[model samples]
Target: MIDQTPLLDQISVPADLRTLQPGQLRQVADELRAATIRAVSQTGGHLGAGLGVVELTTALHYVFNTPDDRLIWDVGHQCYPHKILTGRRDRINTLRQAGGLSGFTKRSESEYDPFGAAHSSTSISAGLGMAVARDLAGGNNHVIAVIGDGAMSAGMAYEAMNNAGAMNSRLTVILNDNDMSIAPPTGAMSAYLSRLLSSKSYLGLREIGKHIAERFPRQFERAVEKAEEFARGFVTGGTLFEEMGFYYVGPIDGHNMDHLLPVLKNVRDAKDAGPVLIHVVTQKGKGYEPAEASADKYHGVAKFDVVTGAQHKPKPNAPAYQNIFGEVLSKLAEKDDKIVAITAAMPSGTGVNLFEKAHPERTFDVGIAEQHAVTFAAGMATEGYRPFAAIYSTFLQRGYDQVVHDVAIQKLPVRFAIDRAGYVGADGSTHCGAFDLAYLCCLPGFVVMAPSDEAELAHMVATAAAIDDCPSAIRYPRGEGTGADLPEVPKVLEIGKGRILREGKTVAILSLGTRLQDALAAADDLAARGLSATVADARFAKPVDTDLIDRLARDHDLLITVEEGSVGGFATQVLDHMTKADLLQTVKLRTLYMPDRFLDQDKPERQVADAGLDAAGIVKTALDALGIESAPDETVSGKDRPARA
Candidate 1:
């Protein structure tokens, strides 16, 4: 490996970083950026964000006593550089690997990561909470929240800012404006202005002016406040933040250490100041040529060559599930003019970009407001438009209230295209689609469907599009689909009905979502042991297929329910139906699902295997339920292999 980060090698932690002189920080930032690029090239994580904040991360740690003074990063995408500076540089290359460093900031990982986050727009709120807690505990430590421009689109950030303003707390919010690209070029004047505004002298002078104005008549005081606001607003264009009751600073250049260090030091020294918003303009992929040239700024990347910036993405044997959803939806929209697509700031991630290519007029990119996206889709649905809200399963949790109230309660035909509906590798538990089944199945008049393969996903899209009276959702996992042939024309399947794939008499496997293939594999394993197992794909999680359940219960000696979801999902629904029907009285039943505890980052296959939702797990569960012990030489190892009595 090339030793490009000579300056970075000297620093083991943020304290080590603070030991360096301010003049040496520019070299440190350059080396840190190089180290970040080198690490991400090996591990394939969020690159552009970390690259953008290399200088800011250096300045923050240098100016403030971190771990003691709480510093929170919103969504934690830009924390890779922060991680490299804060005692985790050794594990930087092991990022997103099984049992290695998490892709996002994790509290358990290090003391530097004060708040854990993967979801956006939560830093300000968490920082305010910490600040308030510090005040109550009679601690005078600083609380700083670093949030991105994209994350500011969410209502939560604004709500936190509003609260912080009202509470008059000693908090500093760093608005990292990387996306807006609205700031003029920062030079000596702008940096000087930023330093002047954030300095303690200016703050004290302003407070004295306020007190002096208060001694005069009410009209005169009001005029003085307006004059001061107008002068500052005209110069910095921070009237909105000023109106929200925060002391506003500049849109300074974030890459310049000379500019960043002084402004940050000024803010840190302002102990008696209320909540302050420092607008720092940054460019995503600032130091990386390949990322800067790309349209999405290489926001998310795969393992790549450091010399060429060419990603080593595996060639898909079949179409990706996300692309299939997009193509199928676009095709449906061609025939039906009322079909519209909406996505909350994840057009490409959710495959809405494909939809936008064909039907540009009908597609809506609703920023990072999932709740607004949900309600907006409902509004379109009310106007007789078949609005498809394509969102990640984890992100849909942010808009559950809108899903329940605006769509489910009103019975609107908003088709929810839930992408990434299972264990997502690398992104970890925060992005896992584990609870969608549990949350959506509980809703009244909801048609929920999970596809087993690519063909099935296409068909389910048609199924959800066909449903007009009530809300419908079709969930599919991330990555490439199984090599199933796509139908020339997608056909709508019968709602609340399941199809039996194989027949047997000894045991039955009722599978939901992508676990159907695992169920079939388990059946094959059982067959090798002289056992016959029936495999059925329970397509609908909400509507329990009683007829199929009854037949499986009556025919098989052991019946098992399997799904790629949490405990209270498809398995719970099936068990609830079985209990009400008294089918549990005669037949032996078992359930295979994700464990109760939150799982950490790992490969998707490894995560499934660990959770006991794989084929081997199903086979073991079946054998254990039937009171038939496996031999010591069995394929599923590391278990107590008891001899048969």
Candidate 2:
């Protein structure tokens, strides 16, 4: 059992932490680790990443002048320990709750958080920009970007490194090499080189050269530099970083405060040093027993018992959308030998792990490189293979260029299984899959789809697998299905088609995705008010079922379109079709979608209600369109309906 931390209680911010001796920092790290675990146990969140970085977080804050000297965290999953030290210790229990602290870093939340980050591999680019801005402004503050080894796989990080090298910007990049991204890292040579460079003998030789160079004459200085460079290249094996114009430092033990403090101090005090890369080897879920035992399982967990490590995940009646996709794909791949699956370091999160288990040789994990994953899938498609690139909707934004240029432009049949289609609850704005519909539909010859439920998702998966002429994408929301009965053999859905569930005369509701359930409920409420409502499920967003839309437009007085996406998505497509077909003159239209602005962290249900996509909200919108005010105490059907006053 962990006890209350007296040292942690006394230190509220980095300033208070700086007063402590280097020897005392270890205790502080322990306390912070315990605190983070305890806090996350109360409110479920990213536990393992933060636990791994406790010592590093403590040392960085203690050694550096933060809030002045900028410290940016890549991916922000490991920012929990940093948050505790940076004046948010008291409110740590409120992590990821509605109106509470965000799961990731936010610029508006605190001055210490110079750049907000949740997506992987963006820190290097953002930090380099900050460093360049500081140089332009004649500022002397140090800019440090702490990035994960997983993040290094993305092209964006390399692009930033190349730019920083050319610019000769004074920047410090701490590569936290935990040997794991979301899943186990793909590359082996980098890890081998890091381990070799971080060896005791190599670091000792580098330290000896630094001391010798201080006493040498001006003429011997160049010779000493050449010797040091050759020694680093020979023993340390960091030629890649050196070639990129960065002075490479140790693969140091990240958990050791003695090692971290002095190295950080040296880097901060270096007068003319250009960008430096410090490879620090650390472990994910370092101190916590349960987390260390199963790193991936504990990466993002529900509320758990701190003592027992038993997670409190609510039992769901239906399978998750991810599992359904994986199962259907695996079943299809058994029949077709040409089927292959790809993921960008998220095998389990995307449910590609299931497919990997079934067909280990066919499954490819392309690390955290989404752009590569897309192009690689396109290459497989050219060879007459069906490649399913299963990536999160938010992360797919990073590979949009490749999606258009490599797949859409070439007319490759790469099936994009877009997971997390709309508002993600605890992960907040940075991870929300709000713009995929708008972004994907705009591409020429791309077949875009969204599933209304689990069964539809299975059909869409089969539909995407069969399409061989062009790029196809099917988006589904995060979480379990609505307990709908799934078919043993998934049926292939027809392209550009919609199905009507209920028929009515006065109002027509067309829902594109998971919002069909809400539309059905709204129809019931509308019927209570003596208004007949028709509900239709629009399976495809790109080539919207023109026949169904035209029929609805002609038959109904008011036509309402709802989707769990932002503007310029499904509703926009429907409106564009209606406008071109001259159907707008007959029917009054209302579109319900996510607001233009980004929403902060909140429950998915609350977000939908607030965005006016819920039953009550839909009823209000329908009633307002007809210029009818709801009676306060009206009986709608058999239920007591609270009317909009």
Candidate 3:
């Protein structure tokens, strides 16, 4: 309804954008910003980062011959505006929806994307690879990687930069410095200097200087180069990049098209310039007043009012699992001074911010470095301190090596609070936490637990704290708990144990994590069909309760194991134990887990239903296992009946 693309309507791709006059780009950037805000307000996604890069996106498309000239966005958080300008404006309203466009950049989505990204600090590496490939094929196309300052904290970015510098490939890296702390004053002087530094004439002069220096003694030649570099570095704050072997340019105003366009054109035309680093300073949430004022620049949002900027977040029926995790951890830390918290950049997302509020001295935000966070926590654990590394399950994948080498191998007592451990709806496959269970369960001497609800989460937090011998982890899902009452004081349960929720004889449903409710619902459905079902919650994936599993397998004619994870996870552990105990000979066993494919963005419930982790799907599996004939209408719940192939 609020489509405000007048000038924007004429341009469908980057080629069309190049047709526009230079002066008209400011108007296009403004319109693009408005369009991005309007679209994100309706769809509820990353707003601020996209807003910051509007002018940069417009300038790049206008100056560079994109699609032919490859451009990559690091982390892809600011790609919404880029998406709109590159033939995706028509489908902008359908962002992050089922069968619609993904929230992040995907190589399969459009030609303009060049490289796909969601996780941070990978753009330079990808761009360098493209640059080398292009050089190998005798191609002259330019490659540019746009990375944010926050993402620069990751070691991978430095590693890529170091490698790119050594390789001396012709690549361009734009460091978008949105942070106020590091950015220099961007005005006429800064713009003129950036433009001059990146110009072809300056590059030619530098090359001439190199040739002249080569004719002299090696010591004097090195001195000449240092003097030139330091003189430029004195004027512009680019000494670090220059030392790293890149021709540094900028501290230019990223929002100023006059400044951006000329500098970008200069960089594009400069021949034989190997790995140039252009430092462009911009504002996060630049155009939008509300986002500018808000902390995190309205980074991630729910669907909202276009006028008021009031986010339309659903009123929660129960406390969010994240809040519960944070609150309980904070409370635990109050009693235990040695209990410390560490999060790799995501403090609020992983509930470590709450821990920081209570115990600021003990909480550490390692900043976009998952590897460092794990190893740092392991170091703390060595000093007899209880360290809880609260990281998202998807992010924890980045630190698996540290988890195995630093913690598991050393047998450190570091507790891992893995948030978002299952299907994270709108974030799609990239952010889905489907493999933490599988990955952690396989690690020797690791205790992996998943909670059924908030109360169990609190208990598991305590359980993990109590375990001081080996590394432990508690995996929990996103969104709110199932309205389960919180305990006044959390209890530490016995490890390698499970609780039977219901008593029955026909079918035994063994559940791990949040699927316990679905298992209960399935039991009710089986009861309606004149079949009794027993439901048990196996909280721990590793050190699984073989006693409970064997009892269920032997007692029931059909045994079913359900978990909200990938293959080789909780269900695999249960199956392995059952097979080893020789319980599989008497009973018909069926395992239900996430299917072997990446699920696209959709409602969480729809994702679960499609994965056959819902109540109806469980009941259907049970009926199929027992060889019972039933029509679709006769299934457990009409609303939840699985779509048959």
Candidate 4:
């Protein structure tokens, strides 16, 4: 356990911290590291990344005029330390909780957090935009974008760099190279170059050249510039940033304050330097013993013992949805030699690592490049291989254009296993998988599916494996399965079909995804109120289960569709089919979907209830639609009967 320090107790915000001497900043960094560890041990959030950037975070705030000078953290996993320094230390323990601070950076959270970020590789673009805006407004405040080495792999970062170079925007990009991005980095040469370029002589000569260039004309400095570029290219491997038209600087030691403060001051003070890149190499989980040893496992953790570093995760009765998918996919791959699995730097998170263990040759862990991962899978599909491109639904949004252009347009047979397909808990609005169904179902020649339980997930996996003509997707939510027994031999579900779970009259409750459980609970609530309700699981979001939908519409007076996704998803598809079939004339329709608003971090149960997808909420919706007022004391299990007149 770390002891309370007088220095940290005195500092409430960065302004207070700025009054301290440069030598004293190290002490602040140490106390900040201890405080961050203690806070996350209580809150259970992104621990490793924040630990890695402690010195960098401290140095940035101390050097720059924050809140005025825009500082954007890429992916925002490393923002906990930033949050601690920026007047949020008092509420740091409330991170990722209901009515507390968010896990990621939010613009609404603080003025210091100029731009919000939860996704990877977006910092450069957002920071460049702020810098341009500042220039247009005639504001002289500096703009800095601190991004990870892993984030640089995405094409978006390069695109922003290209544009910033051309526009000659006065922006600073600090590359936080930790050599670990959820997984070990794929491109080692880029990592090596970052280390090699941090030499003292190289940085000194570069700084001298910058000063000279600012004072002199382009005509006189041409010969000297060619020599410097050649020397840099020959010895240190001229960074790709330089070729794109930005001034490149150091691969400094991020943990060393002496090195960081001076270099940062030089970069910040440099006049007319357009878009500088400072590559700083640091270790993930730098301070904590347990985290530094096993960085990946400690990246995201539940509450843990401060001394032992033992996380307090409760044992689950059933396997997680991710593990179930991996286990089933591994079994299928044993029989089918053509089966291959791909993940974009999230092998363990997506459960592709389990598949990799069985067939290392067939499993591909493409580094943080989602766009490249999608197209690479398309190429493999063209060669007659069954490729399972398992990615989180939120992360898949990054590769939507590729999904449409490469796979859908060409009719490739890439099986997309979209994990985390609904309201994911503590990660909040940014990580919620609410748009997959709406986006994928709109594309032609695609088969989209969502399972109600783990058993059904196995069946869908088999179904997706069998799809060889067109692209197919199976989306599942995060967390443990529904305690359903796994079949010895998984069955392949019929394409575009749904199954009825319960038969009734008057009202038919249709569920598209994992909300089937809630739908059934809502049925019980309706039944107790003397209203018979039918429950059906519309397994596939696309292909609408036309026959089952028609049966329900014809027999029932009211049809209420429930889904875990946002609007324009399963409910909209059902409504579209009903309108075309002219069933709206007879059946009254109501759709219960996620509200058109971004919900903050909380428990999954709370998120569901807030979204009105829970039993009580659904019951209330049905009662309101039927023009029946629900009694406050009514029971859902039919135990307490209301006297019928």
TM-score, one value per model: 0.96, 0.92, 0.97, 0.92
Better of 3 and 4 by TM-score: 3
For model 4, residues 1-645, the per-residue Cα lDDT tens digits are: 458767888887788888999999999999999999999999999999999999999999999988788899999988999998888989999999998898989999998888889999999999899899989999888999999988888999999999999999899999898984322222444444443344455556667876797678876687677776676655444447678877665556788887788777776776567788887778988989999888483789899998989999999989999999999999999999999999999998989989999999999988889999999999999999999999999999999999999999999999999999999989999999999999999999999999999999999999999999999999999989889999989998899999999987767999988889999998887887777789999999998899999999887767899999989888988999999999898778999989999989899999999989998888888888877785445433222333222
Candidate 3 stretches with Cα past 4 Å from truth are 1-4, 631-645
User: What residue pairs are clashing in model 2?
Assistant: none
Tens-place lDDT per residue, model 2, 1-645, is: 459798989898899999988888889998999999999999999998888889989988987899899999999989999999999988889899888898888898888899999999999899899999999999999999999988899988999999899999999999898875222322344444444454455556766777777788866876877776787766555568887888787667788776777778777777457798987778888898898899483899999999889999999989999999999999999999999999999998899999999999999999999999999999999999999999999999989999989999999999999999898898988889999999998888989999889999999999999999999999999999988888898888889999999998878999988999999999998888778789999999988899999999987888999998989999988999999999889889999999999988888999899999998988999989987897335433212323322
Provide the lDDT at 389 for model 4: 97
lDDT of each: 0.90, 0.88, 0.91, 0.87
lDDT of 1 by residue, 535-581 (tens): 99999997878899999998777899998888888888889989999
TM match of model 1 to true structure: 0.96
What would you estimate as the lDDT of candidate 4? 0.87
Q: Tens-digit lDDT track for model 3 on 1-645?
A: 235767888999989999989999988998999899999988999999999999999999998898899999999978999999999999999999998999999999999989989999999999999999999999999999999999999999999999999999999999999974365855798889899988888889989999999999999899999899889989988888887888899899999988999999999888889999999898999988889998989999999887888999989999888889889989998899889999999999988888888889999999999999999999999999999999999999999999999999999999999999999999999999999999999999999999999999999999998999999999999999999999999999999999999998888999999999999999988888877889999998989999998888777788898998999998888878877888778788999999999888999999999989999999999988877877333434322433322
Residue pairs in candidate 1 whose N, alpha carbon or C atoms collide under 3 angstroms: none
> Which residue segments of model 4 deviate by more than 4 Å?
180-223, 233-238, 295-297, 631-645
Worst 10 residues of 2 by lDDT: 636-645
Q: How close to the true structure is residue 618 of candidate 4, measured as C-alpha lDDT?
A: 85
Return the top candidate by lDDT: 3
